[model samples]
Target: MQGSFCDNIVRSSTKDAMPDSLGNYLIPTSYSRIVARELGLQERELPRLLEGTGLPPHVLLAGDESRISGQQQLQVMTNARRISNDPAFGLRLGSQLTPRSHGPIGYLALSSPDLLTALKSLRDFLPIRIPFAQVDLHEQGQSMACDLTILLPAPTTQLRMLVECFALVIQSLVESFLGRELREASIHFEYDRPAYGDRYEKYIHSELHFAQPASRVVLPAHLLTEANPEGDANSYAAARDMCAALLEQVPVTALSMTDRVKRFLLAQPAGSVNEENVARSLYISRRTLARRLQAEGSSYRRIREDMMAEMAAVQLRQGQLSVESIAVLLGYHDSANFRRAFRRWYGCSPQSFRDGVKPE
Candidate 1:
């Protein structure tokens, strides 16, 4: 792969980002080599799937080559999937397969009332689990859309299969949740059309766009408002609250809109921050900010409140600072207002949050 192209595919810190969590699930390069050997293919033919590129397959397997172009990596996956006949082979091979992996996201998506809601739930919940991939839900003409952007520091040698598997899993889960396939949606890829594009079309039963602006799956806008057969309003509310609390506690450990907002706040130590301020810093609009957060099943107000609560809780627990000082740290006008907000946040007064809870 060209150096520039490889740079685009991999993440900034490749060594730290490898998915080793899927213990027995990882089908390493050695495993692939074994499969190829069983099929009577020479080691030289291993990289043949990447016909135009002179790089060896071990570069991807051994972590020697830091990057691979998204296009080239996709091409290799398409060829490998075709030859291997395992639709889930790539994810099963690449990921750290574990019970705790991917978390409440699958449940939230399934429990949502409509396709839009399900997608929004995924957008909100995915960050707590898979930080490497950012998924967006947007309105497209009369339809709705989902964009899946993967952030990896190393060449995703099996990204094609990973994308296909994610698309399949999302589609299947949507159909299972709504009790029907997406009737008026389409799938799009940022990479070039591959050899198995037709198969993708047949599986999705929708138009497939290649080399698109981004990697996304589009659905009709009406799907957003559809009544969910499995809807449980109370449960969803509780889940949302729990997630909000989680976001406040450890913002940097995860990739989330909430976490991003917290990071932004930490970077700007002084002042009252709001959506417009955050949007300006991010180079996006207030309207776009609202829309994106809505897709994530949260609002700027919610994240802001969470940040304040967390800051207050931390200061209070330290017990070294007075209530007035803590209030100022959180950009409050006075202790009374900060106390009210604290009570609302933890169902107890600021004094209680300080004195009652044990350190985490």
Candidate 2:
């Protein structure tokens, strides 16, 4: 039997190149911090969990407008699974996630007049929450299905984590609006059953299916018209307006020089993305590259520094490598200098940061 209408969302590639002047494909850091918190990770433990993800610890700590790429976000999820030793971590994570956990998007959905309006708002503003995925809502006979398509390449674990978390979140949102769980709703996953698959029943009360063609959630069509008891048209309009304004800020551009540089850095091993080498790869003078990046609100030195700090924190958290080794890995010649820089980035010494001990 088919799972819920929103089941089996497929992943697809987009022909459009990376947008211009956009620092990178990013998702809100709030979501990452939420996942980390729910997984019981402490502030100091983040570096290890975020290792190799190219995400700066400060971004998550500051909880500002900063963003991390879809790839890095996936790395955090993968790390959480390993650290927590829970194969059904995603299911648990989703069950605890409230609409407000999504920030403005959550507010917008909560204020929507009905399920259909809420889903449409979610579809349109999804980019503001997770910029790397696309949502498609389809109408089937007596049912409505919402399919999720990820634009980035993801491993099996990352994909499974994302699909499962999203499915549960959607289910929770619908239940909140209906003031009860939709007994007729269901969930579907494209992957094979995991060893801990039985735990899914704990969170997903509806019918569940695996080894399907796509990942999606399905709901009965009649539920679409169910009025949200808390919905206020004025609140929804205000939230929607704010969401639209934010989406407009997302950069869109054909491949440009800035895009090329980011792509180059992502492909290279950590600490190897010096300006001279990057310039050589692009067949341009170092000065020319600097000028272009400056015009784009970025610089090679800034990018390299951010990348180095992110990788350094990750390595330190892993506990497998020494402080000296991590410094050299990031192209530093002296451990003393690395420690000083680490202090500036995270406001603490590397040792203190990695010990899962925070400075008072």
The lDDT values for all models are 0.55, 0.69
Instruction: State model 2's lDDT.
Output: 0.69
Tens-digit per-residue lDDT, 1-360, candidate 2? 122111211111121123224434567666776676676664566787788887756454421345666667788888888888888888877886667666556766777788898888778766666667677898989998888777767888877877887887788888888887757886878899889898988889899989988888988999999898863464344323323332233333344566566545543434545788677555457898899789989898787676667667756755666787667656677889999989988888999999877753
Model 1 residue runs over 4 Å out of place are: 1-102, 154-157, 231-360
Give the worst 10-residue stretch by lDDT in candidate 2: 4-13
Displacement of the residue 204 alpha carbon in candidate 2, Å: 1.0
TM-score of each: 0.41, 0.59
Candidate No. with top lDDT = 2
Error of 2 at 96 (Å): 3.4
